[model samples]
Target: MHTPIEGFSKLTKAEKIDWLSENCTTDAEKTKQLLKRYWNANSSVQKIHDEFIENTVSNYYLPFAIAPNFLINNALYAIPMAIEESSVVAAASKAAKFWLDKGGFKTTVLGTEKVGQVHFMYTGNKKKLLQFFETIKASFFEDTKAITQNMKKRGGGIKDLELRDKTDKLANYYQLHCTFETLDAMGANFINSCLEQFSKTLQKEADVYFDFSADEKQLEVVMSILSNYVPNCIVKAEVSCKIKELDEDELSGQKFAEKMLQAIDIAKAETYRAVTHNKGIMNGIDAVVLATGNDFRAVEAGIHAYASKTGEYSSLTHAEIKDGVFRFWIEIPLALGTVGGLTSLHPLVKLSLEILQKPNAEELMQIVAVAGLAQNFAALRSLVTTGIQKGHMKMHLLNMLNQLGATEQEKQQLVAHFKDNAVTNASVKEALEKIQTH
Candidate 1:
């Protein structure tokens, strides 16, 4: 039976682990051993990982890899990727190579606006509140001067502030919608600080206003936070080649072009297909995001929201073959930072940025977008020709073999065997068992 302990966080890491193992595990010694196995042998490196978060356990690691031959906007780059998925790096590399001779990927930053909101409730006259907001709108920026000073000096700061009336949806509900430009940083902290200051200023101005009744002036501040749904913080990446040049030895150019268009259309029309389709794209986007130490979860949430912006979840990548040209592309909103958070702190993240030739935030957005576009192109190319499972399962075979405890020699043999044989769980398991028996 587990009981709550007071001040658990106050305990040392070893002490916390001791208490957790004793109460939470069947064998405390075994749990301790298991946790210690993953710890870095270097004490200084271990210490750095420990301070990254609270209640530190052993470090959890993912494979750090690079996909070379990426030519984005006439600049060649070897993009770094940090992910566990076996096929992602391989697929992105393949896409980059395929497009290398086809003019590579061209990218553009459409917008760089990020958003936040301050929510509050007021039961007073809506029209009066609107008028009051108009009169005090400038004060909102004026009040957050201290917070926005550095950001403003850096060519980024509060863009606009507006009061949104939502009484039709919820009684006495309103929002102070705000937008900002954080320059090269993700700006969550900056945006949030400005929003909190705005919330304070809003309530203060409303309270002291010489309005009608006391009820009209009473404003209840709910919450102030940054929004991850930054649709305006968008970038587009694309590749285009003449349809006649789409020739591969396996399939005719016309057939290949037609099949790809049809595939994308299915993804656009079907939710089931679209969900998986978009996930493939994210596998590429997330790898780069993770390698650069950006917020993948926030990026994921904002992207999925954008996918359903048309009232139905659909493909993020679009393909069109017209006017003798085949164009494939993706436009996604990625709120990324090149200067703050883990970008400068994490060693691998710094290395990853260096590997990318040190792109600023806007350029980083374009590169990430290109990674996703390339990945989708490779996936679609495979799906329309050799089929996804054949290549994906082939890439996944080593992972499965390791999971099943295959020896190195056995893995080598199975790798050769599966080159000609279909890779499935049953097939691999049977072959491994047979190899051992022989």
Candidate 2:
């Protein structure tokens, strides 16, 4: 192993590449070439990408694709998705087309509140500490006026603030629990700045208060941060149609509806099934989140935490056939932004937002939730009827063909041959060998 180099971030890009290739790679020239191959040819664009993160090597690329025919809330949109997976965009598109004739998707914005907290420890009497908190409650807002000014002007700012006692959970633990409205911005930096200022105010005021002994004055500030578990920032999307309308040439409408409902029930009852079920939904959600330049990891964390909010990990989508109607819906927590982060920096992100017709945060939330619901419907539909591998493997065929070094002509032939045949590694290989031998 090579010794860790200090000041690695201080190194120039070319120098950084040199050092990494010399120390970390087997074929240094090949490594360097491959890394530079993915770099943007334009200098300014490359510079922007280099500064996006530390230790810039090369730009990693995912296929940027569009899934068309989404009709959301009486408006139509063609969603942009950046992903490498084979069937995700296709599946979402198919679901969208199926529901397009069934009145499309209806969405509701349930809430838009986000949370933050300032934690501190106080080894003093609870009664006097709470009294001191009451005296200084106004100061928290007063001190954050500068930070909140622009946000307030935009109809978004601190919603509420309160003191929380956590002595039972941990000795001397207390928090300034807070909520905010961030509008079109994700508001991580905004919430964090407010919480930190609140902590500063807490310390400054505690030093001057004359309510108690020296022990009470020495309040230890632990940390200040925003919570990713944004249960309050929620959106719901659903599609419904007459139960008789689910009929396909292969499966009857009532049987199809019954199987779809049973699949949802299994996902709810079994944790193993629920995890995979939710993953399928995220396959659609993360693609759009990434395309629109939002924090997929944070979205993922909050959604999963929400899934387990009932203390058992369960399905994110629900279905029912009642009164001769088949309805499938999903409610998920998504904290997204349209004007901040990579929205302005990444060129593709700008195009994605424009493609979505420049949705505000709430509208983006609705679009994202609808994508997830569509993906789940497509997956469940496949599971109950034709089985997953038939379609998944069909989409997967191209990757296998390329991996086997098949030419474009051979690819076309094999694709046609597999049209009425099953797809597997061995089957594709056998088909290719037969073609080669002939």
Candidate 3:
């Protein structure tokens, strides 16, 4: 048992590590040294990271990798990925290369609208509330002009506003349903700032409106925040070629396409298959989103919701064989930023944006959707031909070797051994033990 320390956040980095090591770790010195080992050597760079979050200890690192040969809309790109999972980048790269000559990928931005709401409960008469909302709606926009000015200049801001009544769903509940075009910025701050101001303006004006009864004027303003489920902020990416173009080493093009289509059909019909199918797509989307300093969690939430928009969860990617043309595509909701948040702050993020030639939010949206589609294609291709584990385990072999503390020579030998043999945790361990005993 350990006593809790007060003002843990106020402690110095060294002190925090010391306390954590003493209380939480068996070997305090080892834990302290290990945590400090990940710290940036440059003070300036380290300081930037420290301020990124509270109770800072040390940096957590992930490989910032690239999947090149992606040809989208006639332009070539090498998309950056930041993830820990093995073979995700390799799978994406393989897909990119495979599609390089098949017209690569075609992408389109479907929408750029983001959503937010000011939720409240008013037991007042519905007629009076509706009347009051109509009169006060313009004031909401007027009050948020200062916040929306810069966004408007960029041809993006306050696309729509409406009064929504949800009394039928939840008693006396009402809301200000609002939408905005945030352009290259994810605009959470802008949307929230506007919604908050709308809340203030609504309450103030309601207090002064002449038609309202005493209770009607007592408008309760609930929390105002941006909605993560931005179905309107979506992008579509597609790839297509003749059926003959899908030929793999193990399967003919026709057989591979049929098997892949069958797998996708199951994903569409079954919840379990759909969830895992979408997770693989996220492996690619999230990697690029993280590398570009965008919010992957929001992107993920919105996309999963969109998947169930038809009343049942289903596949994000769609496919068909039309007139001997084999096509696959995905339309996903992705609210992303290229100029704000960590994009301008994190060094690797800035470098990543430059590597992709600095795409705007819409452009970034397309690129991310393509990454997801490419990943799904790679995974389905493998599943239809060689199976997912063979390649995945091969890519994961290095981590397994490291876990066993195998020397360079041992790793080399084992890797060659696994080339003709199946790689598994148990198999690798057995092979390593045999090499050691010999």
Best model per lDDT: 2
Error of 2 at 249 (Å): 2.8
lDDT-better candidate, 2 vs 3 = 2
State the weakest 10-residue window (summed lDDT) of model 1. Answer: 209-218
Alpha-carbon RMSD to native, per candidate: 1.5, 1.4, 1.4
Model 1, residue 415: C-alpha shift (Å)? 0.8
Pairs with backbone N, CA or C atoms under 3 Å apart (clashes), candidate 1:
none
lDDT digits (tens) for residues 1-438 of candidate 1: 999899998999899889989999999999999999999898987887888898896888899999999989999999999999979999999999998998999999999999999999987777788889999998998888889999889899999988898889998899999999999999999998899898899888887873647344457789999999999999999999998788877788888989999999999999999999999999999999999999999999999999999999999999888898889989999999999898887889999999988889999999999999988988999999989999999999999999999999999999999999899999999999999999
Each model's TM-score, in the order given? 0.97, 0.97, 0.97
125 Cα displacement, candidate 2 (Å): 1.4
Task: Give the per-residue lDDT of model 3 (tens digit) for 1-438.
Answer: 689789999999889998999999899999988998999999999999999999988999999899999999999999999999999999999999999999999999988899999998787778888898888778888898899999999999998888898989998789999999988899999999999999899888877864556444457887899999988888999999999988888988888888888999999999999999999999999999999999898988899999999999999998998898898999988999998899999999999999999989899999999999999999998888889999999999999999999999999999999999999999999999999999
Cα displacement (angstroms), candidate 1, residue 349, comes to 0.6
lDDT of 2 by residue, 1-438 (tens): 788899998998889999999999888899999999999999899998988888998999999999999999999999999889989999999999999999999999999999999999888778888999999999999999999999999999999998899989998899999999999999999999999999999988987874556444558789999999999999999999998899977699999999999999999999999999999999999999999999999999999999999999999999999999999999999999998899999999999999999999999999999999999999999999999999999999999999999999999999999999999999999999999889
Whole-model lDDT values for every prediction: 0.93, 0.94, 0.92
Count of clashing pairs, candidate 2: 0
